[model samples]
Target: MISSTLIFQSEMFSDWIIYNDETHGEYLVTVDHSEDTCYCTCPDFQYRKQTEKFGGAKLDDNEHHCKHIRKVIQDGCS
Candidate 1:
């Protein structure tokens, strides 16, 4: 099972942290407006989502939602 907890968040709720119970992994996630972009420190985001095909752009705009990023968005940045 995977889950997330908000460790820190800016007033705008753009940046925060998420942790995994099973993997004991901590991920940093950032949500940026003007694009609703989500960045995650997890390997999935670094190696898979953030790709080299589009000159280092996210691999697939519609499919780049990493677990950490999705959790942040679902949590309403709370």
Candidate 2:
């Protein structure tokens, strides 16, 4: 787990986007307020289950957080 805290303002939801360094691309990151979760089009998030099973590092304590989450937090997704 990366012991870092990334905070985002509540209003950043509308402008939140996911950027990929490898592909030099960007995608919209959707947040499900009702479910209190976020989703991304990146392959990391798409195949997170397999990644975790293979012992890839988790973004947070649990398997919930990922690079996408870190990006959102670092970008101030408020």
lDDT score at residue 53, model 1, on the 0-100 scale? 42
TM-score of each: 0.67, 0.49
- Tens-digit lDDT track of model 1 for 9-63: 5654366778788888987887654344567787778887764443222313537
Error of 1 at 37 (Å): 1.2
Error of 2 at 78 (Å): 5.0
Residue 7 alpha-carbon offset, candidate 1, angstroms: 5.0
Global CA lDDT computed for model 2: 0.49
Residue pairs with clashing backbones, model 1: none
Query: What lDDT score belongs to each candidate, Candidate 1 first?
Result: 0.64, 0.49
Candidate 2 residue lDDT tens string, 4-30: 223233532333555556666665555
